[model samples]
Target: MSEAASIAEMPPRYDPNGVEERWYLKWEQDGRFKPDLESEAEPFVITIPPPNVTGELHLGHALTYGIEDILGRYTRMRGFNTLILPGTDHAGIATQNVVEKQLAKEGVSRYDLGREAFVERAWLWKEKYAENIRQQFRALGCAFDWSRERFTMDPQYVDAVLEFFIRLFEEGKIYRGWRVINWCPRCQSAISDIEVDDREREDSLYYLRYPLKDGSGDIVVATVRPETILGDVAVAVNPRDDRFRDLVGKTAILPLLGRELSIVADEMVDTEFGTGAVKITPAHDFADFEVAERHHLDMPIAIGPDARITEVGGPYEGQTVSEARVSVLRDLGAGGYL
Candidate 1:
């Protein structure tokens, strides 16, 4: 056999492990991954969903990167000026949690380090994780424009975000007010609704009796969150329900707080649900907030950001939601209101 044919026929081995680094280094060095802005080729762009700079890539990340790489390669072959811009997210709350856990190992809190020092530590963490992610992407043969790599916390990005916020404020689209929001007590930050995970778990249902202002019998309300009962401004019942139709327009005395709550009729109440009555705690529950708005009722905040009962909770103040639940349930049983 000829020398070249003999060498080629000896063995056929596909070894990406050996050649990947060399090709990636050459491609980056030659700037082949960068889009030719001056080229007349039709622009084809794909940006990666910037992964959090708090951890290494997982299987899901690998799958997404592979799909994007395929698209980038296909577009490039089709005579298009393809650009795959790579970036990492600061992942504010998530990255903070990581650094906080590291600090916890030394029996220290972020407060001990102060804001500036804590932020410095977080940037260091981001650098480490971000590099790790880049290395993983390179190993996967992802053709990304490293020249245009960005971070969410970059100065330019921060300025852009501030500009957007100011624009919304000027447009009267942004306003700050006390509203029921998903809160993470551990992180001590208000999280968006999308960050919340909904799941079914076994929880206790507390059946409490609210005495009528009139010499009539008490009305029962079954709730899983008795800790919020202290914030109740009204007792809501379905207007169509014959059982509570006459009870409407009267007042109910809140058991523990002794607060007078109007017995209001709202079509929003689910009569088929437990007790056919619902307690309106506008400050704690979103549905209750809407009812409060409609009825022009007060919104009493009974829980603070720490997930502890606030001063509005009276004697239960300073107790965590779980702790207050036990106390409230015990008191209800003692008073024969359960």
Candidate 2:
């Protein structure tokens, strides 16, 4: 029998421990993983979804790399010039938080280290964690071109990002404005919606009475967050709701702040929910922020980035959200507004 036929008929014995590394190293040394750009062969190119340089790889990384490696190897065997590029992401806030925790261990903050020193420290942290990820990829037998490895924070990448942003700004595609954003108090940065994790949690709902300015009567508005009452700028109700139809053009007195709040009719209010009335605290709540913008209402920020009540919170200023909730509820109950 031919040698190839004999090898094909051999018993199947899976032993990756010694075999994988040896074959992978040989493949690298033989330059089989490198693709010739000028070649006429069908090209199969893939760039890894760069893993964060903030930490070591986990089970998720293993699974992802395994699937991609299978594709790369399959394409190479099919006579395609496969090029799999490997890279690591700076992960911005994630990497910053990791370095910040390290700094905290030594009783120092990033601000204390200064910008230049902090950047230097962050790069060192990236280098350390990046190598760990590279090894994990190799263990998974990923046939990536290590010579083409890249980092999101590299000088070329940084320049490209800057150019993109500058082009957008010049074209009027980018502009700064006061907008509601998902903020992380710990990271002290704004994060995108996808970064937020949604989970079920038990919470308290508070109902407060807002007295009408014309002495007609009071409207009860229910809220899960009473601490935000300090930022109340308007009281909204569905225009189609008969209960609040007559009070649309009137004004209401904000319970705690004693500020005059217009009783506005906005379609955004759900007539079937919570007494059909909602207090609009534009700066704190996203829905309220949109309603306030539509009606041209003022936005008062009662909470700061630290999750503490701000100066606009009146007597509750400087108190954390939880603490202020207790104080606000206590005062509301005493004043017969609860």
Candidate 3:
């Protein structure tokens, strides 16, 4: 309708669509793509990297599957019993996110539907999109065995997955442990490191005045994220820096939260950076988390999964990150610690 050239008709002074319609579909339907199991021809098998049933296939899918299709065609022509096995992955988080967004538009959430009902909606979503994806594979005129197409959540595939996990468990290969992870506040889920997108932005650095428990004049440290001060376990200075060398063993009181923060000297601290000292909020910042581990200090969480200030933040508890930042700065300014 938009006058975009159909891929089938995209060729030099000729139409591949006619050839494709008369041959590719019949060649595929006649089982020309499927390798003969009984034949002694040298087997050339390649299992597809399953695509998620999220939506229509994109250019990424075209690039990958196109290469495989070429290889499959070449092998079959060379008298090899080529088997290009095709399948779809559940792609768990991505699929759930799609369904949740749909439910959101209807003024409901997965919680309202409950686990069983939510899963039902997910299946319905999968069934709809998975069929479209399968059809797209055929529309591309690839020599794939549609009859043998599999879904990751199919009973047989599920059984195979469970068996593999059970074997790993029996060998004591999997265990639970405390560690830092990337959490999506919007999704309320933990995602892999690959899912996080890093961005560069300019920000103002705030100089926070931390009071000494001994009633001595305050020591100042600089930070870009003043909100995480509620979780501060320690303040670190460069061990080689002469400025705060004497104050290394002293205790500094966190301004708003009143948490006792030990002043520690570490080589990781950048002496040339702001104020030659940095606050260590282990639960909120990765660098601070590492510093805490080296000092054998407790890692108290300042924020919850919803990116809201937790109970440990005291007066700022339940406030969103932005809201808490304003409140924390306001209180800090009132107390003359900003």
Candidate 4:
């Protein structure tokens, strides 16, 4: 018989669509994906990339498992022993977000549920989703060693991560504090720079006044956010600005918010931007953050993580930041202080 005819007569080498479920269950129950130290055959292994726990099957997953399966199955076909390791990132932020969303639907917050309860919910969610993922991988016929599955957030795995972080800190490579972190509102966490993609577009600029402490007149200042006015801590100008040289030692009455602030000269101020003066809300903008740090100005965050005006924002408290901005501007303009 011809080779092609012989193969065709060989019952199709067992159709996966027909036997995949039964064989996969049998293989998993038999621990086919487990390591065999007794095997002396040349070992080949390939680890798959970890995807987010909430992730659905995408082109990336397809391509990744496809290539890895090719290598693993090819090596086994060549008579070498093979193992394909599979895993995923615990991805704290993404997992936490999923839990938080569930909590939100029931009108409860994570803080109310406590860490343990929230975590339990997350594990339940993880278990349900992980099974789906395993099925998807099986459907692809990837030969991964399922018994040795590693989760990045598993207790054993977390110990390694904690140990690494401790070692890195000891080596002076890692530390923590508040800074200009790119925070994700949905995730309620600070994401690394690698996670951020900036797109520059047109943004409006607002000109307003920070009146002198004596109520004489006002220092005209420019800002992109009129809403940040409630958070203003200082009005800054170049130290050498001829028009405001005498105003260096003075104070400015913060409009609407009534937060008294100083008129200070900072070298970082650009002489060419908006009346050569800027209103500094240390809690809001990056430049103001640096200016506050250098000037030892009190920097209290006036906007909460929810991006609402915080309690320290006085009358604007509890309002969405954008709404607070409009209200503050109208109040200021109505009072003839705009």
Candidate 5:
């Protein structure tokens, strides 16, 4: 007997064409995927987490859908009215990226097409991919209610979201507020905490001189962003650090800007970072923001959304951070402040 033609004459491949194809199609045609609304059985509802329209099924999605399908089948066999709602996410960022890449290939940009046209392109992209995701779910044999399929931007869904928002606002459940956040200069947007990728990188620690207002002596404060010193509200030192105990009550003249910076003592200041004295730019640094709030210091906007110096920068106003840094450092060195 040859290895290729063994006595046990079963086919190597299990062809799904004549078997799964017929039954799955019949199930869909007979409306088995949807629950019998008039049935007396107990209702079982599951709204599966929608996948991004710009994405495809990966190992994770396959595994999750498989388990959910098993549970759904078991519940159906137990005579429950199963209603597994299916949907695809609008995935704002992901969809934006897809369209942006398409535009890139055509040597264009979102700005070139303008807001209205760009939005049109986005919708077209969504329409093309949304169906593909549905087909993927169907191929995975997910017994979901396609009749009740949802897209977040659907007119009815939008209305529901608006109603919820209006109700929340009327109940004083939501309000505008300010706090520290992770910002993406390239994307020109504020991102959620989960979106931030924390990694280690090397950068220079700057030591700059802040002369005391009394013309007595200069105090050196360390910072990473020299351009933000234009908005410096205070010089912070660890309250328990003996090195800066006497300097705490004093006032320091901001080097190039000539604005007076209060020498504040706060336990939040890291004793080991830089020179045991850190410049407090509340608008730029999270720890400094908290320190300013506790000590009643002013929080002025220094860096703009475009990453340019704000009006607070005086001579460096309207310059990009990198551009302003070079000029600021040159001026500081020339003025014996660096």
Candidate 6:
């Protein structure tokens, strides 16, 4: 075999173990990662999307870094000064969840520890995880400017967020109101609309009977949730429904409370639903609010802030909606109201 062929045919013994570490250390130590404004090299800047410091390297991060590293290396080979900035997010919700879990193990709470001490503890946790992530990124051999790392909750970024809020407020675009915001029960915070993920849910479809005023007949209605019955403001059907056409102007006697509620016709009703009637529970459901508004109906709030039946629910008050549903239904059936 030719000399070149013989060398090529030799058992391949290329081990990246030593060279990878050695090269990284040399590049970092020699300040090759730092930006040089004096040099007239064309710049190719690309920043990796910051991951939460509280998270670990999953399949998603691996894929992201692989693409970024390929681009950075290609640009570098083309003789451009490539700057692939690397960083992590403080991710207040995620980081806090970690620390809170740790505190829970010690039978302590963040509030009990006080803000200063809790923040200190959080900083300690951040330092540990941030170091781990930094080491992992280094292991990946990403040509990132490690010297210029940024965190989302860094003082500089915090200033930016504060400035943004102030500017929006000054423009009269940021106002606070008692609105139903998307709340994260686990995170105990109001999640931004952009952060939410819509999910499919399999819910119960319940049959409920709303009694008539003269104690004669009961109107049976189907609901995805029997729990919301306490909040029922009005019963509605399609205006074109011949069955309920005469009942449109009548009043419905609420199952448990004997409260008189109006019967209204609206286009929002799905004609295929049981009895072709939908109970309007404005305080509990958003769709009901619009229907109530259109009909000029009185909205009696039945669900409290704590998600339990309110004081206005009388006998069913203080109980959870689920528990109250059974009690209310039983009473209605016993009274021959259903």
- lDDT for each candidate structure: 0.92, 0.91, 0.88, 0.82, 0.87, 0.81
Task: Estimate candidate 5's alpha-carbon lDDT, on a 0 to 1 scale.
Answer: 0.87
The 10 consecutive residues of candidate 6 with the worst lDDT sum are: 177-186
Model 3 lDDT-worst window of ten: 1-10
As for candidate 4, its clashing pairs are none
Ranking of all predicted structures according to TM-score, beginning with the best and ending with the worst = 1, 5, 2, 3, 6, 4
- TM-scores of the candidates are 0.87, 0.82, 0.78, 0.65, 0.83, 0.70
Highest-TM-score candidate: 1
Error of 4 at 206 (Å): 2.4
The segments of candidate 3 whose C-alpha lies over 4 angstroms from its true place after superposition are 1-13, 29-32, 35-45, 72-82, 100-118, 169-173, 192-201, 213-218, 239-250, 265-268
Which candidate leads in lDDT? 1
Measured with C-alpha atoms, the lDDT of residue 237 in candidate 3 is 94
**Regions more than 4 Å wrong, model 2:** 1-13, 40-44, 70-82, 99-122, 191-199
Candidate 6: which stretches are off by over 4 Å? Answer: 1-13, 28-47, 71-83, 104-117, 169-188, 191-204, 211-219, 234-253, 257-269, 273-275, 282-302, 335-338
lDDT of 2 by residue, 1-338 (tens): 99999999876998787789888899888887899888899999999999999899999988898899899989999999999999999888878988999999999998999999999999999989999998888888889999898898789878989999999999999998789989998778998786788899898778899999989899899999998899999999998899988889899999878999998999999998789999999998889999999999999789999999999988889999999999999999999999
Q: RMSD of candidate 4 to the true fold? A: 5.9
Lowest lDDT 10-residue stretch of candidate 1: 9-18
* lDDT agreement of model 2 with the native: 0.91
Clashing pairs in 1: none
Q: Which regions of candidate 4 fall more than 4 Å away from where they truly are?
A: 1-49, 64-85, 96-121, 138-145, 180-204, 212-218, 236-251, 257-276, 294-296, 305-308, 318-323
> Which candidate do you rate higher for lDDT, 3 or 4?
3
What lDDT tens digits, residue by residue, belong to model 1 across residues 1-338?
78999988765878787788998999999998999989999999997999998799999999998999999999999999999999999887878888999999989999999999999999899999999999999999899999999899899888999999999999999998767888899788987676678999998887889999886988999899987898999999999999999899999999988999999999999999899999999998899999999999999889898889899999999999989988998998898999
